[model samples]
Target: GAERQVRLPLGCHHPLVPLHLHEERPSYVVCGGAVFTALSQPYLQHEWGKAWERRAPVSLVAKALNGSKAQRGEQVVLLSQLLGHECVRGYDSALLANSMVRALNGVPILCLAQLAQLVLACRQRSLRFDLEESRVLVLDTAQARGAEAEILQQHNIPEPVLINERDAALLR
Candidate 1:
């Protein structure tokens, strides 16, 4: 992906951030549920689908950035700009742990662009998209079957133009 400048809105009061996948052990949370080293693409989609069904508000969901308090703080600022919401909240410890904690508490954590993709899916039934990393998408039995290909085709996403071996395997 091409790097681009990001600007926070006038009242957002946070640093600009890039929309990139973050990987770091420090940011890793000890989520109290079934923890897999990696989650599949379909799993992630189903999780997002569920969130949409449950009406999880994107405004309050803290983004997963490079594992740091400051970067995490920047998420709200970025979100305020993206979602056009004013009066943003600062990062909460609980929200910071949301992705993992949700898994522990039996809700799938939609990581990376999964949440955004799911939101897009609700409005547009067909579109193409890319996922930079594998995220654990929690779903029930019915929702789990054949979700990845269907979602990818709906979004017109092709095989990645650039990917490392690890990520390639995860996507497959």
Candidate 2:
């Protein structure tokens, strides 16, 4: 018999892949009532509990099982949650939770850091989030900007945006 090697597709489920963590660097960004962050195994586990594979969103689970990094530093950024605010009136948070963010203001989103930068630097009248499944979330730029502080204050959040210096610098 001859010895043979087999390779399995591990994607983000690979043990060697580092999980994004807030302790290492700011893993989330709060902008215009939306909380954005990269997808991680821990997040899925936390959201769905011990039986995450059975309870988690099928799409997310598929990503975890089948997704692979396409480029260096690539991440699957998602709109993890939403905060109630006038800026986001009438939008159902449940429908948007855990939705993968594909783009913002027509610019593709690569990572949480880049998404943060885009939201902050947009000079347009509106900010548009192109999410998975052809879903769109539009917000008035001026209203979102003005309400950001109030949203944070109301929600008792200390910071509106937080990203590791290295990640931020890479974008610049």
Candidate 3:
């Protein structure tokens, strides 16, 4: 008798990644036992859809309103990453699409649970964290103690340095 093998589907990097690379290597995807390349990015829009797809934005708003400070910070990080912006302010400024801002009422906290869900999805599907390749800002000390710090260390991403409180105040 022959043994049957099970293969899992892994997610791919953002569609734009190929344009920036020197070589056109496929995005990193890890199947159960083996890894493979996807011919093209899979479900790019789904990354955005996780928050506003089938559900009501009001629910997200309630979640953020009731969530903790850490949750708010996480939401800001995820939104900034998604928009390819280093900071939440930048995302707000550059994002001309009013729908997203309107959906969350421009409250960054409302994006928390969606961000968490997206992160989990990426892990389960073995998707590459392309958003993280961009510059990241570590504002408060809390970020230094969480997974964000671990990711920065793992990627060798340098944290932005503030020489003094004055400089730190400018970031705020």
RMSD of 1: 18.3
TM-score of each: 0.21, 0.83, 0.17
For model 2, how does the per-residue alpha-carbon lDDT over 1-172 read when each residue is reduced to its tens digit?
9999999987543321234454565467887898887787778877998787799888888787677767656677889888998778888899999999999998998777889888989999999999999988899999988988898899998888877664565465
The residue-by-residue lDDT of candidate 1 on 126-149, one tens digit each, is: 221221222222222222223434
lDDT of 3 by residue, 110-144 (tens): 23233323333432222222222242222222322
Where does model 2 exceed 4 Å of error? 1-26, 165-172
* Deviation from truth (RMSD, Å), model 2: 4.0
lDDT of 1: 0.27
User: Which stretches in model 1 have alpha-carbon errors above 4 Å?
Assistant: 1-16, 19-138, 159-172
Which candidate has the top score in lDDT? 2
lDDT of 1 at 84: 11
lDDT of each: 0.27, 0.81, 0.27
What is the TM-score ranking, best to worst? 2, 1, 3
Span of ten consecutive residues with least summed lDDT in model 1: 77-86
Error of 1 at 35 (Å): 22
User: Scored by Cα lDDT, where does model 2 land?
Assistant: 0.81
Candidate 3 local distance difference test against the native: 0.27
